[model samples]
Every structure is written in structure tokens, then in C-alpha cells.
Target: MPKPSAVTEAPSVVGSRLRQLRQRQGLSARELAHRLGISPSAVSQIERGVLQPSVARLIAMTDALGVPLAEVFGGPEQRDEMPEDLTGFALQRFGQGTEMTLESGVIFRRVSPGRTPGVDYFVSTYPPGSAAHPESGMFRHEGYEVGTVLSGELTIDFDGERVVLRAGDAISYPCSRPHRIHNTGSVDAVAQWLIVHPER
Candidate 1:
């Protein structure tokens, strides 16, 4: 079997929507950068699609803008426009979902057709040597994650303990733990991840 290739193209919509959100929040690029502890030029680069932020940075950006991460991916406005299905179901066709390739070389594609209150469903691809937290090594949030490795190998580090997962393996853990996801294999590691956010 052939190894899955890395997804290199990041949709420009993410950048544009982020910019719109920042502007709508009445924040200048410099102010946003200050809040993110990054340079103004870095913010501009990300907003213009010249640079792609790592997942951590993107999350911080959205939080600083007083919006949920989903807002960066079309948000409630887009979700509200989906064609109604009295049958109570909708489909998220292949390539129709939002895709973003981070600077760490990880690709996150939202797979859920619409909002699932406090839930996030997505496919994540981690290229060889890539890590969810490239610098910090670990981070924690308010939620829980359940994921299964579709291919390649991935390692999850919780504090000092490390758990390795191979293709077809699955794991579930609380997001409150300081952890990091790393691709330790030579091939791209792809997984379907579901995150259930803590109630607000």
C-alpha cells in the first residue's frame, strides 16, 4: 500500500476569515500580534496567507479575538446557511470541508457537516517529524479527545509518559492533561479526531 502524501495546500479562506474577524473585533494587526506575542509582520503574513500558523498559534489567535476556533472555519453564519434536511442529516462531501495546513506541516480538515454543539470532528494529518506542539512539547485545554490512527505511527506524550500508536490503533484521553501529539514514523500519520469541549 502507498503511503498517504502530505497535504500542502492551505485554503486562503482561513486567512481571509481570520482577518475579517479581527477587523470585526476592532483590533489592528499590531494589537492582535501583541496579544499573541508575535510580531505584527507575522500577523500580516498569516492574514495574507504568506505564512501558515501552527495549530497552537491559530488557537491563540482565535481566543484573543474573542471567537471560537470554529469561527476561523466559516463559523455559525456558514453553518446556518446549510440546506435544511427535514430528515435531520447532511453530508460533508470529500474536499468540500475546510482544510488548513499548519506551519508544523500538520493538516486539519473539518469533517463534520455542521455544528455539533461543543464538539469538533476533524481529520488530522501529521507529516513525518511533525508535532502538535513543536515548541512547548505539551499543552492542555478544556475538553476530551478520542482518535484512531488510520495510517503510519503517532505518539502521544502525557507529561513524562509516552504512548505509541500504530495504524488501526485508537486512544481516548482528557484534554485537561498536558499532552502533545507527534508523528514518529517515516510516513504521514493520519487520524480521525473528535474533541468534546467542556460545557461553558
Candidate 2:
């Protein structure tokens, strides 16, 4: 299996940022935990950087906090580089975009120059033998996702069906269905992914 590049940003960065967003949203840790169906200590652990959340858990937190997944990867901070009155376009230089690597070894690299209220744009890399959801379980959320594989093999297990994607293959599905993204190939699987959140 190909080794992924070492990502140096500590998990604490994301944990602290998540805490900030939760507080800004006026949600108590316990309340957020309740919403996520997890325990308060789990939330606290994540905020304190003692624990790194899985991809599904992180997405659930973002959904609970009403922020796009990119925000967890420093989207708001990246926007600081843009003009206050910026209107039409945004640019993210190569290797300059923020990224968040989940505890699952799946890396989500933000490609969008700024936050899109109900959308997430990024390049997701699934290391060999890595899966997005924890413990081989399925994850469901409120959105629609489309991914185009760039290299290696990416497998989508959804609604009791399994589909394998290779370079140049694309797949789209409603997030409401239980699904999992896994890299079952020997090499790293890289793909461009976009998720459109359900209208509020």
C-alpha cells in the first residue's frame, strides 16, 4: 500500500475549532452530545484534543453546529485571506488549502476557497484498509454526495449493496441512506468529493 503524506497539524487544532464553533452556536457540550447521541465526556474529550473524532462523528458535529464540514478544517480562517467585500470568486493554491485528517486515517483536504453555506468541497484520501465510518458501520446524514475517483479503488457500501470505483469513475447518492466509503485496494484511494447539505 502507498503511504500517505504525513499531515502535521495536530488533532487539537480541529478539537479547539470545534469547541469554538459549538460555543458560538450557544450549545453546551452536553447539549451537543445529546444531539449527536454520544456522551458529554466524548464531546469534552474531542474538544480537549484527547480524542480524535471519526469522519462520521465529525460530520455529525458539524451538522449539529450548523456549519459546513470544511469549517472544521479552518474554512472561516482561510476566508480571512479574502477581501471583505469579495463577491465572485475564490482561489485555493496548491497545498495551501486546509485539511483535517480523521482518526480513521481518512484525510479531507478542503478545496473550496471559502465556506458554501450548505455545501462541502474537498479531496478525500482513503488510505489502504481505511474506512470512513468507524467499526465497519454505516453512516447516514442529511445531504447528497458525489465523488469522482482520481486514483486507486474506492468502494461505496450502501443500502446493502457494494460498488467499487476506479479512476475516472463517479458516484452520487443521497446521504440519508446508510453508507460507508472504504479503500479496499492496495494503494491509496483519492477522490474529489462534494456534499450538498439538505436545505434547512
Candidate 3:
């Protein structure tokens, strides 16, 4: 038998973050849904992480909440005290960044020391045979993603097309396209992801 992959299960923090921001703004779920032009159940699903929001919806959500896009992804301090100068810099040591796991069993480590404008950086690890979406399904969001495989193998499926990548291989694509990534190899796969979001 083959050895088990390094990753097992990972959980996403998006729902928690959404809930936190909503409460901070003193908006109830129904009120938020009304502002977003979505149903209350839809808002519930998003806040519960049962459904992921599209890029456009995410922008509308931030606008409704009167917060920057980075506020949604940043820690409490970063959200509260976002620097106005992009030139300001900080360092993040190995294993020191914010870590999260998605429902798909992928581990994500935020690489930046704190929230920066325009982009979100992450190091992701996928377990063998694991996928970002269910088989034949896909997920779409906002922004552009650039990634390179660091170890094992990664398979990206965009629409009906599939591309397999080995270590050192890289890919860049729009997040608007329906897509998913899978660990097709028999070992854990690690990759670095850079997601660029539109300026607010």
C-alpha cells in the first residue's frame, strides 16, 4: 500500500470572517442579503461556508459593508488599521502566517506578514487524489490566480480542458473561469498561489 498523503482535512475560515464583519457592521443576515440583492438563505449559506461567493458578489458585499476588499481577507488588526502606504513592508517567518483549511482538504498558509493591497498570497498543500471541487464540478471566484507546483503533481481542470503540472511547473489564469485543482499524483502536492484582485 502507498503511504498516506501529508494532508488530511482542512476547513475554510471565510464563513467565520463573513460573520465577524457582518456583526461588526451591526447588520443582520436578512439586512445584508437585502443589500446584496440575494436571498436570506443565500446569505446564510455564504456565512456558513456552504457556498462560495463570486467575485462580483464579493465586491458588492464589501461595498455594502463599507470596507475594503482586503478587510475580508485580513486579520482583525489588519482590517482595523490598514496602511495607506503600499510601500510599508513586513516579514513573515516560516509557519508564522495565517493558516486555513478549505472544505476540500487543502491547506493554505498566507505568505504575507499582513494584508497588502491588490493581492493575496498563499502556500497550499493538497492531499493525494484530493480536489478543490467535487468530481466534474468547478468553483468560480473573483481575481486572477498564478501558481507553481512546488512538489508532487497538480492537475487543473478548466471547463473541459485539463492540465497536469509537475514540480517547477506554473500556471496563470483568470478566476472568473470555472476551474478546480486536484492532486492527481500519489503523493501530497504543494503549490504557491498568488491571487490578484481588482482595486476597489
- Cα deviation at 79, candidate 1, in Å, is 3.2
Q: Per model, state how many residue pairs clash.
A: 0, 0, 1
What C-alpha lDDT do the candidate models reach, one value each? 0.78, 0.85, 0.72
Clashing pairs in 2: none
What is candidate 3's lDDT per residue for 1-200, written digit by digit as tens?
Answer: 55223222122366668778899999999999998778999888877778765434554576677664456554576553436775666665554455555545666665666656678776778889777664557766667889999999999988889999999999999988988788889999999888888666
Rank by lDDT (best first): 2, 1, 3
Looking at candidate 1, the ten consecutive residues that score lowest on lDDT are 2-11
- 162-196, model 2: which lDDT tens digit per residue? 99999999999898989988999999999998999
lDDT of 2: 0.85
Query: Number of the top candidate by lDDT?
Result: 2
lDDT score, candidate 3: 0.72
Q: What is the C-alpha RMSD of each candidate to the true structure, in Å?
A: 3.8, 3.0, 5.7
Candidate 3: count of backbone clashes, pairs at least 3 residues apart or interchain: 1
- The CA lDDT at 96 in model 3 is 46
